[model samples]
Target: MKIAILVEGATERAFKKKLCEFLQSHLGQKMPRLHFITQDGPIPKERKLKKLVETLLDNNGYHAVIALTDVYTGKPDFKDANDAKEKMRIWVDNNPNFYPHTASHDFEAWLLPYWTTIQKLAKHNLSAPSGSGSPETVNHQKPPSYWIKEIFRTGKRGKDYNKVIDGMAILKNNDLMIAINACPELKAFVYRIISLCEEDKIIS
Candidate 1:
């Protein structure tokens, strides 16, 4: 199977690479041919996503297309995460082959609930305290990237957190089940991917 993922930027690209690996390994399925979207075109920010999806679907090779963008990226039309997702859903027009998932505030919010897992994986003390409340509610004040950097900077070794390197490492090494349970948005995205795999007979 082939799947195209339209992500906001490099951080998301890294995250999706790890996520695809996790899904393939855990579900015992052959990994899909994954395509990452780029921003080299002249399309406007708001319309760029739809254009990418349309282009991917037009190729006729991809079985599924998923768009992942952060809610806090300042899309003027969206009032909040739900608004952004709803707009994308309408734009997708009930197409089964296309799915839209938004990371509330930012993608890093998904990591807040797994502080202990991160600490263990990095073998360093995290400076940020464990957050509480719903995933969106808990860390809406700052981007997850900021918090992660702070955690690494204040650790015993005082290392800097590289989004592409350390972020992907943390994601790969951490407990997938724990992350799925803690983050509702992530759970929804993963569930959709699993369902798609099942529907395609890639996994039973």
Candidate 2:
């Protein structure tokens, strides 16, 4: 199987790499091929992205095409997350192999549930001000990336967390079950990917 993933940034690319590796291990198959395309920054222009997707599908022999973008960046063509998703759904309509997944707030929101583990690993003394690391609470008031940066800046570490450098390490060490339970959006995306794998008989 061949898969194409269009992502917004380096951190997402790293996370997808880990996710694909996990899927391969779980499926016990090395046959599934993954291709990553970086959008360089947040995807704000829906029409441009649609055109890009069209070109990719026209040129590539991918079994599946998945688009992952953060909802916090605000798309120019849509008023809100629901609107954006609906538009994307329409764009992908009848394209059985295409899937669109949006990360609420930002990619860092997925990591918020595992903040405690990250703090421990980074040896940072920062604590969640709300005393809870739930995604809903943590991602409610601020962009998840900003929230994470605040923790790193205020803590003993003093150094900013580099998503590209540290994100995969943190994800690798943390328990995925905790993330799945804490983040509904993430869980849904994971389930979709797994379902696709099973549907294609990549995993039995």
Candidate 3:
């Protein structure tokens, strides 16, 4: 089956290759073809979002369309993961073929789990983000993106964090499962995709 996933800009589109490889580890030969469509930012809201989903679903060639958005999008788009999903569900009229997923706060939270790798790549000794210590728990007051950018800015070598470049380099050698296990929103995101592919649901 062919699936269309609406994602948050260049970083996610670039990360699609790693996602498919991770899914293939479980779904194997049954992995569905995934197309990551970048929105250049967060996915649209309300009627615009509904129209986007409907248009993708309207194509018989696609079995489903999933939307992936971040909770803390710099502007108050969603209160949290559940709020985002519920609102999207309402906007899409609870269509079975349309699924919505979120990166709590933002995608950079996933990268936080690999802080050891980040430190090496950044050439900085800056400690991991302070909080409850859980990546997802890194609240929106500052958010993961803020921490990431801060590290890159002050680090001896990092200088800057390109969402598409440094983000990938940080996660490139790491397993997606690490982030999924550490972040509830990430788990739900992977769960939706794997379950739709008829693969084992990740329980962590």
Q: Indicate whether candidate 1 or candidate 2 has the larger TM-score.
A: 2
Give per-residue CA lDDT, model 3, range 150-180, as digits (tens).
8888989946888888887988899888888
Model 1 lDDT tens row, 1-204: 788767767676667767877787756755566777744221124465566576778866788888776777644555676887777867756566778787776777777776775676555775554453355544445657666777676666556777677677777777666667777888877777777666554322
Best by TM-score: 3
Q: Report the lDDT of model 3 for residue 186.
A: 79
What is the C-alpha local distance difference test score of each model?
0.67, 0.69, 0.84
Worst 10 residues of 3 by lDDT: 195-204
Assess the local accuracy of residue 6 in candidate 1 as a C-alpha lDDT between 0 and 100.
Answer: 71
Give me the overall lDDT of model 3. Answer: 0.84
Question: Sorted on TM-score, highest at the top, how do the candidates line up?
Answer: 3, 2, 1
Q: Please, what are the lDDT tens digits per residue for candidate 2 over residues 1-204?
A: 677878888888768766776676666664367787888896635567666666677787777777777777743454445665677767655366667777776788778777777687567767654624656344435767776777766667657788887788778876676776777677767766666667554322
* Best of the two (1, 3) by lDDT: 3
If both were scored by lDDT, which would come out higher, candidate 2 or candidate 3?
3
| Model 1 segments more than 4 A misplaced | 38-46, 74-77, 92-96, 120-133, 200-204
RMSD of 3: 1.7
Question: TM-score for every candidate vs. truth?
Answer: 0.79, 0.83, 0.94
Clash totals in order = 0, 0, 0
